[model samples]
Target: MGIITAGKYEGQHPIHPKARQILLDAFDQGWADPTQISSQGRQAQALLDQARESIAKSLGLKVDEIELWGEPELISPIAIWGAPGFGVSPFIYGATERSEIIGMRGKSKQFFEISVDIDGAIDLELLTQTLQPNSIVAIQSANIETGVIQNIKAIAKAVVAQNAHLHIDATASGARFVKPSYWSTLHFDARSWNGPSGVGVFALKNGARWSNPLPHTRPTRAPNSFSIPLALAAASALEHWIADEAANSTRLKSLIERVRNHVKQTISDVDIAGNAESTLPNIISLSFLNVSSEQLVAELEIEGFSVASGSACVASALEPSHVLKAMGLLTHGNMRINLNHDVQDGEITKLLALLPGIISKLREN
Candidate 1:
């Protein structure tokens, strides 16, 4: 029923009426270049000011430290590229948290990847063992596909011990899942939080230096200034989503547990993937024995249940999910249930009812 397949505002097909009007008003008020000082420019400037203020509050940071970008993917490569010739090997997560990062690699002057554990979290021991002089470490705070929560505070400690510059990609790091202030406490040099997708918040801690991917004159270097409107909307959504996270998480977790229990009781060989306790409350990845994830997804869709086999962003690819592969799990027949803000226990129950029968039928093939 939803147009966008991810994020806080999932399942609401049309834009939220209030959020839509907010964007409309913002657009009407910001029709000119904010860099100018004319009447229209002043209006744009005011809109941008409000936008930055809202985003900064969402990320627990001052407005100036948060660099707003339309595309969130630009943050890491930009930061890595901008660093003053470290001559040190950079340590990237064995896997990228976002799809865009795949395209962003190799452009940087130098870097290496650290392997993640079976749960898709980077191994702490391996990370500590690999520490060396002039190491630039990039770790995603939360994994997007497996919903595996990394020990950022612990990893940050390790990074600091090695005197490395740590850049966090908190792209899908849900506010309820990870707090921005905690990253601040860890002293991350520059961290990029995909302020709920279309809104990218690149926070450079005070006295931190990083390079911008786009090269323009010093005074005019913003990639997309009009992104202010999207940022405002995302900030509004984030605040609304996070405030209710505790209750929602509890509710969703209960529903997922029920689903997991039901599958375990009814289906003999199905594997419920992902970290049981440390994963995001909204995501559950399960694989039915001897079935294709593609087949299961299609069958579920036919039954009027919309979900993903893996990462929804890359579901259509022929290869199995990289996240599942990283986790050392069976990639076949993997179905990822992503609960939305509005999804209820009743919906989970209904899906559970249909799941076993479908699995039985699919496996007969």
Candidate 2:
């Protein structure tokens, strides 16, 4: 039930079935080094270009602007910290930004972290006040665990007024939550569209003031290290998602709202962590007072359901979720649900029916 379950936020989504075949086909035809001058090399290069072109069309970016970075985790540092400008600019970001972006703070010349409210929206006034002409800002369009979306439009306006660069981490929501015109650099995860992992795509807007921080012989060198077949798979997945899953998004949103409402009405002392109106459709976060998230997760598993805990422990310690902590929400007794295309409405109904009893039983102990 790993990829088959509704609890899909944890690991690599199994590559879309159609994309899997495309990957196999690509390996057959695209295995040669695209940089070589042989006939086979030209064919492989053509396929790679097509892959980039397909993904670029999906993201509303030019073909030349995209890079096929090998790892999603590494792309953050490459796009954000790799910029020479960030070294001297005033760094402004919400405290709830992903660990990859936040971890770069020590290197910034001047940085300010604006705290988020209970709903996980970045503080607008404080953020606006902090922006400078050479400011560098990193903001996630939505939180991965809690699905809280920031007001990118308003944030971008402030940054633009001060002639600052904005790095938008659209890893959680992808193009659905992004505004291309507002970003100096934009990143998206192929895995978000059930594409292959390690196929992270980041775009450099034309005329952006940045260069590869990675050491290179030439000052104008760029990096492209991902597998060509995987790039094809990622593009295929995006096409499949746009054709098949985008239409179902509305129905899923409706079901998600019903879960939020049902849980709120039937349970007490439960903190629904994100703003209902502004969050991503595929993720939900809930915290039950007086219950162990570990217990709830285990109990739900026993009942043939799969769910994850917010602040999932690492190295045997219950790591606090920076998103929840920054929002001043409960850090424990939390459960996160991530819906996939295969998760049926019936499964949602069943989970809704099972939650109250399992939660009560866990609390009673």
Candidate 3:
């Protein structure tokens, strides 16, 4: 049986052929520590620097503004809560934000949630009213579960107007959309764009008021080191994705719309989440009445299709999705489909044809 799951967890994609080859070729050089001054180390350092500069160029940032980190989790706290002169400030985030930003609630001096519209887009008006001077605002470029893209440029303007710092989680938007130039701070994971996992990029615009959140004796900004090969592969993947973005988005949007329209027409008591016109082209979320998401996922997997429910990043948890709940949508019987760049038209067609019957059977059971 062929596996055809539309919604992938963590924006996982098959590594580009070129990126895979680069990774393999760098295995020997990647093993050397770049911090050392030896010949082998210097070679590894050159490769690492090249990767850093390439990634920075892709994101429209200077090399010095970005740092390679082990994971987004390692850098998020520092970016959010660590303002240079401010001890701790009020934290504000959208209600539909990922669990990572939500986890920053009590870590700040004060926490507030900006409401989202029914389509899962943040209420910019409310955000404008909520901002205070010296506040730290955390926003995502796109929602992972709902595929709702935020108007981060506008949001950033508001944050900057209030003399606040903006921390953007662009992990879900890495290859799907271009980075907004107004971002004060940005975060991304390599796995989001068909790059290897275990690597993340944290970028801070020059003159952004930020200090180290972690306790350390050393004055180094980046607290940890990642594999050089992984960084190079990530850079290659991102560059490839950027080059092919326009064509891939058009194709994926067509496929997603086909599935969305088919599901709406064929399934009863089903609701499609997110605003398609302003969302990531490759992701679609649908909820069916009286169906258990876990059971549906299991049944689909048995039929050689893998799907996800709730927050893909925290799929292991049994609780209802905070994102759907915050959007005032039903959380049960939900499924998310993420199409990678290589997903075939046939695969999408098959999934569309199978979904209606599967929903009916599950409801009956």
Candidate 4:
């Protein structure tokens, strides 16, 4: 079998074919600085605005409420900063949220960690109890590594009842599911939706209390920062995804479920993260007892398959997955399967056939 991409395309998936075409066509049109007062610049500005409108329509937002960033790293902190409260707002987030989002906790502000159960579901009751009126709560719409989905609407309800704000990190599962209707601020990576790299999108809900977290003279809420071609590509891919979402999502969900069931029934002493009923349909996180993820990933690579082995965000660091550890699952021997929307059942079947023997041999060694 040929090498297959099981890595969830979030941030890593290549641009969709139609989106790639849009990107190529946009290069000439979007090359000029949209801020400039030239004819070419006006064309670029038009392309940028059109892209934003397309994305807005897909996500159910007005064009003015959205902003694009060329950098993904700073989106979380910046989005959190622009929320209802920043320096004074006591923040609370799930234990499994991305480091960038949770890292903001110690800007010398009060914070709380919403605990997750073994399945990586955050404690909703405890979260409600932790709410402080006029506070800010940061949370993941879905876990990137475990594919666990949160009851953010319920959390949002609690936050709103307390007169607080909600910042949702939908980077992992954005565009795969319906966009949440309730949020003070929302952040998503363009890469999450089969777009080019180095682009992220965020929105401050209309009438939501927000301000520029960074120093800027521009009246726009965000820096108006991003590659114009890439932004168009991202928006185009989102449209394609939305059009095909129902079928694609159902297929991806079925594939992940197959992988989950096979690993549990065939592989001994394996731990699977996330509950099938509540998790995203596209990702599966599995860990085998007494096996090394690094070694497993290498072996799988040699077998013409590529799977993620650690926290997706920090995989290059070769660190233990904070999410698995937080959920009390085996942090070692972890394998994450991110189903590409177009992946074949044969590919998964091949992967399934290889996993049992590979795990057995690794455990024996």
TM-scores for every predicted model: 0.85, 0.95, 0.93, 0.94
> After superposition, which runs of candidate 1 have C-alpha atoms over 4 Å from their true positions?
1-16, 28-30, 86-88, 102-105, 108-110, 177-197, 219-224, 311-314
| Model 2 per-residue lDDT tens digits across residues 1-365 | 43224343423556789999988988777477788799888888887888899999988888878887777787776787866577777788789888878987888878889899999999999998888888888988888788899999999898889888888888888757667456788888888888887788888888887778888786642566778888888898988877756678888788779889999999999889787898998788898888888888777887777776765451144577777788888887888887777677887888889899988888889
Best by lDDT: 4
Better of 3 and 4 by lDDT: 4
What range of 10 consecutive residues in model 2 has the weakest lDDT sum?
2-11
Question: Compared with the true structure, what per-residue lDDT tens digits does model 4 show for residues 221-288?
Answer: 76766788888888988888777676677788788889988888898898899889989888888888
Q: Order candidates by TM-score, high to low.
A: 2, 4, 3, 1
TM-score comparison, 1 vs 4, better candidate: 4
**What's the number of clashes in each of the models?**
2, 0, 4, 1
Full candidate order by lDDT, most accurate first: 4, 2, 3, 1
Better of 2 and 4 by TM-score: 2
lDDT of 3 at 44: 78
lDDT per residue, candidate 3, 26-110, as tens digits?
A: 8854466778788988887787888889998887789999998876566676677665433366788889877777887867667
lDDT of each: 0.61, 0.80, 0.79, 0.81
Which whole-number lDDT from 0 to 100 does residue 271 have in model 2? Answer: 86
Segments of candidate 2 deviating more than 4 angstroms: 1-11, 28-30, 219-221, 312-317
Task: Give per-residue CA lDDT, model 1, range 127-188, as digits (tens).
Answer: 88877646666677766555667888788788678666667766555454344333321111
